[model samples]
Target chain A: MSLILAAESLAEIINSYAECDASSVAIAAVIHVALIGAFFGLPAGIFIWAERKVSARIQDRLGPTRVGGRFGWLQAVADGAKLVQKEDLCPKDADKPLFRIAPYVVVIASFAAFMFLPFTDGWSAVSLDVGMFLLFAMLSLEVIGVILAGYASGSKWALFGGMREAAQMVSYEIPMSICALIPIVMAGTLNLNEVIHYQSADWIGVIPPFLHWNVFHPVAGPAFIVYFVCATASCKRAPFDLAEAESELVAGFLTEYSGMRWSFFFLAEYASMFLVSAVAAILFLGGWDDGFGIVRALKGNSTNVLDPGVIAGNLLGAGVLMLKASKLVLIQIWVRWTLPRLRIDQVMTTCLKYLLPMSCALFLAAVVYPMALVLGTGRPQILPLSNDVSAEAEMSTSSEVEVERAAADGEVT
Target chain B: MTIDQYLFALFALLTCGGAISVVICQNVVRMAFSLIISLASISALFFLLSADFVGATQLMVYVGGTIVLLIFGVMLTSSSALLQIRTSPAEGFLAAGIGVLFLSVFSFTVWSVDWDRNEAKLAGVTAVDVPPQDYNEASSGNTVRPLAMSFVGLRPDKAGKAPGYLLPFEIVSVHLLVVLIGAAYLARTKRRVSAES
Candidate 1:
């Protein structure tokens, strides 16, 4: 969806420079790369700052007060500066090449995953049809980077951390994918854009737009909870974070990492966290839609106009999507501060023994649900219920007109 | 060059470079990392071919799942200091020569096929001038729905020309279940001989 829009925009811009020539292509490519860098780099810095602040507030303390003024908003920047200047040390016995390259691998995987995400309708960097699958795939590659980082460290602690992450991530992925499928089943499409579009439809001609979100559906409700749990674990956030249990593995896969290299791992973590949450928002929550049709109204009926309302609506919708994702990220942070990290065995058990079966059941129920609805009500879908509501409104309006006509006739008589 | 051509060249370089790196790298971990690069670039190649679903599946199943497991196995069994398992130059050269020979044969077989003729026929076009509608026909439609439908015993793509995947999907799922159980069984720690015993 966004690719089509991007192609159109590129074509329009390129028209002034030349046709779809090399120079125009080069300009477009550079711009796209810059945008991707901004999206990736900006989130890493903000989320790190947000995490510190949130954790500090939870612990009843100010996280950063001295860096760049009042709230220490530039704390991440200061930290980045410090990290950059820090010595890039390598252990004598460590695999030099793989150790140096591993962080970049992780960064690239996370960056690639972000490209598939749609901030607003028709605004993704590379709106491929298999957006969700591609995101999961790229994210899955992050594990390899971690494993390499751990193995390259030549330390028992790092190796343990890397191995734990591999097992945890691979196991958590099964349940996560299944849980994500529940909404996909309901939406009848894998396209993330269409998934959110499906959620905007009302239920039974009476349910409001907010109620229509997949998180509110009987089957999808549990699936959302399960998905979040799996997502948290996959992101290596607290509780499931045996990979970096400070008390046990001494920072896990990150045990040997220092300075910017260490921060790269965290960057990947925060980015993946945002990615999964954004996916959840798109899959279960009403993605960029405000749920009250405000955006639609702002967009108006015009097709060609790029007026303020249309632009504002898109910006607002993107803001809403990001806000929802951030809320989820905050909850993840809150959970991290509150919950105790689980043991490795417990983490595996949680995913495979509990969440896996639960997600499968949710998938089954979600599939059976609409079919059962069709059987019971003879209705093919619960939605387009907004259409039914409008029809009912129309019928009532006609009845009122008939009553008015009868009253006039009686008065004449 | 066109943007698509540049992208193809880039990805092709990445895929081949990664493949060569995997063979050249000594350490098991580095080899795994190189293999990951190769697999990921192959998926990008799949995307260039416009098999979006296949590309993603390749990434998810091969790059993400299998490679992680492979690395896990390597980690569990090998000591970090001894992970570098080097081969002799003569052996390396022999393997490289065999690999080159196989590649040449494969490329020759691939180039022997008349892909352009087949594609033109599929698009119902003669000469190189493709109308927009015909060009659209050349690229496959969104595969997600058709893929899903096929899993449920519906082949809407080519109608009766192709068989549905429902039974195969079921079989694969069942096989995976059995494999999962077997892995769990294999991985479960044997009850320690009682200290008393």
Candidate 2:
């Protein structure tokens, strides 16, 4: 079910039956919050397992052969159990309160970001109009926890790790936000669901629906590549993992953390990795829409929430989104193992000297592309798609009308 | 109370508590941390008020960008000796006196305002003159487009009679550029002097 509608319906059912507004709303909120919490944790567990297995295969070794069958699918669960059992340790010199609180800050920031992400059409926990902006804001809050963890540890390694994270995250956010804006410029809306709807129609009728994605656009294609690079760095994965460079900083900000306190950091990291990948999928790739449009066909003008076909379509759409996101995550894992980590200076140089300028140029190109198309083809869009071009034209004409009306009023006065 | 009022009360308490913590905390890092909490809860208040764009911008700019840089500076420049700077009791008393004075002035101004009359005036103005669609968008928390348009000198909500904020926006951008260049220059000069020495 679309979570928003489901929540409303659940509340309505309770209100009709019991006739208490506050209790009905409260009950619905609790149930949905629990549902979203499970959804948040499940992906992190699965991805952690995938990370270990993928890294193991790349290095030519058997990983976790003894747990949950030969494939060791339950290895992540075992690891969690082990981590939970370990003693939580705090350094004597550490700022104890801040140290204890830091990991929760990181975990909460990433989990809250998930609330803004839609798994399928209208499936978000909170369907704000400015979902993407709010999501980015929430994601940026994770750095504070890392910085606190580093500072509060009172260890030199942790301090250095925290400093590196502070500098790196601050620097990389520039190019990352600019790259994200490229798609927003194209779609002319900050709403992720609207951006998905803009990409729903097939290009040129005979072309596949997948090609309708923004990544195929001449400008957004390069922006996507830069965005992925910046995203990897932003997540502090390998090649840009200077903040937690184990060889140099002895686990960086994580040097003083142990047990579940430490596991919270990892959970936040893996969850954010998945979040950014899902965002890239939604923005550059088609979000939950299958490439074949089979899901759309299944949904087929059904507004009824309990319709079996709509339910199936939503499930299928969510599965497709997850598959796309996981594939991206696998690529991230592949890059982590296959590539050597960059030096701190090199990482900064890559973002500042290369990605920053490149993303800016891409933003400019994205702005000009439609204007150039309109000039050349006498239409705002060149592709034989749906109502997007009309929508654009209508927006332009509406503004033009306002301007004309203003001008006429001035003359009359 | 409704959920919105409950949330407002909660966040308002958090905001005040964080501000108090900032004033009381001896450790500089702890002070900064409390300041973050205060600013973040203020953003929560913005969200509760249905100013979604403003709330997000507050989070992004102040809590994420500005305070992180402030803490970064604190960590980089402070030696162990300077980590915790204790204020004298006299200084504390002076600060508290000034704070009380400021609070009284603020409360006086707030109390003097006829808020209901102003709100009614605003409603009367917009209701009669502005189209319902424009008014709806302004009130609906979907202010991104209207805000962007107004920044570019098109007040869709005002029927285009009033000039938008384009001039002031450009001035702020240029002011920010100047500050950036000044900072870069100062850092560069300091580095050159250190290298020469």
Candidate 3:
């Protein structure tokens, strides 16, 4: 979070220095793009390394222990160096231009989705109001690149893999989106940042603030399970990895891809895995908020003068968020290793038959729960904040002590 | 040019270039890919126009759903080697001439409109006084709410002589239901005579 603030302040400083209108905006935009790239690129490298080590541990074996000494942490870097030296290949019957351009389309679509995801309170590359919807839109574009890669490969196996992927992905989107919507309904906002803020309050004014997370709600509890299942399927991870069934389809859509091009697809894959987990963290679990409220205490006491305490708190918040998201990713890797891959037909049936209807039922219950609470108990499931979430956020920024006093008073009475 | 104008130019180039490629390409799959590019650029154009919800919908529905279906249709019907379908010279010439004429008429109609004056009148302000709200804030509010409200028979954004979208929305929904059933019926597989063999 401090990193984002520092980048923003740096951009402001540039704007002040330039005193020019369009150039400053351009410069700021460039900086933002650079920041996004660095954020995305660094994670891709780290996640690949993490995936190897975690998967190896799951399989009861040592993994990549030679390259970087003690933990072989730099294995991904070595792998990248080797990959760049390999020859880029193109099949004789392939569509040259489409084959060449497919990897970039996949990478761009995946990277663009990260723009709308908030790492912490008010920390994002672009905080769109329709952030969730836009993220879905960007993610959906990844299918186009996969389809192109398959068709352009001019291999029968590639075509089969591509078509299977297209079908599975398109079908899974319905359930995934419906499950995601349950949290939105609970939060009463499409903005991911606001959604997190909504969870900061106590549940129905009785339970602890940490338990106020949407996943704890009965309707959202089932919805979170549905969401994780759909999210796994969406990311094309096992057991839903029908697209790249290595045993049957010969690496499926990836048969013809080699060198950096092949690695680009994996980069997109791992990044999206991290991304969906982060989204789940923010939506279902409390985002950047410690379940214990220790971070909240720090946040409530620190002044906004960019003091050491404030910076430490912000960094702690970001670290907590990343840690939670990483835990989800680790679970994904664990599932991938433990579960057997499903057949294409079974995958389709699981989504359309099971998850779709289940999500719909959960959505109905989520909507009805509030009405039931209002009618029976005469109180909503989640207490309405007297001040808007953004207003409270603003108060925290101006004078933290007052915000803490107000919070304490509200909690007591 | 400002960043907005520069972005507009970039997106416009992509949209026009993609459209041209879609028309000129002989291979069905290539044309479909080109159409995806065109549709995606159109979505970006929507973003540049400060219509984020519309842009996202375009990307999701058109680029994601429709184009994938189009590619599936092409793949299912044609062999890999025969994917390229050449157009007759006479038909190509006819299409080119009609396309040029259509473009000219559309450009003429657009240039003839007093759009700035109409917007000024709507806001009840001079062009200079127009607050840069719509121009600047690309992703501030959830545009979906107003759009949803309009679909459900409300026109809160327009106070005078505004039409609700309820009827159209319902009609579209029914139309989609019909399409779904029809497509399912058409796509049902026929059992082969394996017993005879």
Candidate 4:
């Protein structure tokens, strides 16, 4: 929905300056698509470099020290150039067409998932009402491509890897989704922007605004931990990366892939890692809400996109959001380097026996917490932080009115 | 043509093409892949209609969940001999005949319906109860609230005049739970028997 608004506004701006025969919406869309492409691609490259450096530091060894100077910041670029020049090959036994198409499917699914993710206020490409749900749906599509890649590779290791991935991803999704719902239950909306708005206000106008985030909520704090764990497993990162257990499977589903094809899988992996981390940041950490509340002061309830203050605030929010998400991503990388990979059975057990029940309990607590508070006190919130008392009262009264009206209508019928 | 029209044309063509390919493909895996394409495109059509929640649900439940399970089942159960089963000509003909008959009946029923009149009737039922927040707006397209309200027996679209599907929804939920439990129990018993043997 935001796509249409952005495009229409861009079109209006273009028309005021000059006349063009081309469709303005199409032009705007192309530009947005290009921006999104860069957003999706550049992060994967940087994350790859970070992963290497972080792992090297942990191992007490220098990693990629000379690729693009001392820190080897351009190592990912060098690797990409090399991969581009290398030959793309398909095994003779493989299903040729499916094998070729699988990497693209993975890339596209990961990229599409970004459309629903709001980096800052009013900045998502597609602002669907079911933003979180649609994002999950898009992310889930990635597994299909992995499964196809495994099967189409026509190797036993590849098939095993695919089967493991299918089982792991599908099982973990149940817990991950439930964990996500903990915040949704608290926020009372599925729109990511609305969820962030619910966390935008400071606690008691004295405490830091960041403390008001869902992560600080008693129930949601534990749920965030579980969500991050499941997010790691979903991204096929260790200690749950049984799908690509190097010693056992020779890169598993990627055994047959090389060159640009192989890099596509890496790109998808890093992008999804970043995507889930960003989602966690939005869902738990105060997304784009710098602890200082300076951005909110700048925004000041203005809905106008053209406002210079709003733009500055949004840009700052975007920076904060990216920083938080990047930190989470770093933690994921740290966990990958530090922990040993779990066996397939252990991974399944961790999800099914532990994480699933834990997340379910968190979800129940989140739901009951507010209701319990409402019953105990006059207000729904235990903390007399914000103006939630009046808001909760207004909501209850409106619902009560709705119930009365429904009862009257029933009698008439 | 407008962008919407062009998009509709694209997805519609892909849907039909995928369905046709599913039938024509000799390999079971390839057929499953085509089925995924068809189902995903159908979800895209739902999105185009501004049914955002339904579209996402369709993509998640069918394309993401069901198709993955179907592919997994195919890969696990099939041996090399069973991978490419050839249908008998007689069976093929019988199946094609049944499919054609079903298609004809569906088309005939669709063509016979006065869609405009039906739409007017639906609008009449819903018009008076249109909430302050317009859910059908292209920009917001928020149907989740209304959908949830209706599921819980409050028919927001009908101003609480019509009965909601709360009872049936509960029944279906219970039915699914039963099926899940039964499947687990059955699988457990088989594993125990195999262990004993």
Which candidate, 1 or 2, would have the higher DockQ against the true structure?
2
Q: What is the DockQ of candidate 4?
A: 0.42
Q: How many Å off is the CA of A27 in candidate 4?
A: 1.9
Instruction: Give the DockQ ranking, best first.
Output: 4, 2, 3, 1
DockQ of 2: 0.39
TM-score of 3: 0.88
Runs with alpha carbons beyond 4 Å of true place in candidate 2 = A1-14, A202-204, A386-413, B118-140, B189-197
Which runs of model 4 end up more than 4 angstroms from their true locations? A1-22, A203-205, A387-413, B89-109, B118-140, B188-197
Q: Give the winner by lDDT: 2 or 4.
A: 4
lDDT of 4 by residue, A1-413 (tens): 33244355566677676765247667877777787888798889999999999999999998889998789999999999999999999999899999999999999999999888888997877766788998999999999999999999999999899889988999999999999998887777788987887777744556666767889888999999999999999999999888789899988899899999999999999999999999999999978888678988898768999899999999999999999999999999999999988889899999999999998888888988888887989766655645533245446646865775676487557
Instruction: Give iRMSD, candidate 3.
Output: 11.8
Q: Rank the candidates by lDDT, best first.
A: 4, 2, 3, 1
Clash number for each model: 0, 0, 0, 0
Shift of residue B89 alpha carbon in model 3, Å: 1.4
Candidate 2 positional error at B145, Å: 1.4
Model 1 chain A worst lDDT window (10 residues): A1-10
Model 4 chain A: worst 10 consecutive residues (lDDT sum): A1-10
Give a tens-digit lDDT track for model 1, residues A76-183.
898889998888888887889988998998999888888778888667766656777778888888888888888889888998888888778888988999998888
Task: Look at candidate 1 and tell me the lDDT of residue A276.
Answer: 91
DockQ-based class of model 2:
acceptable
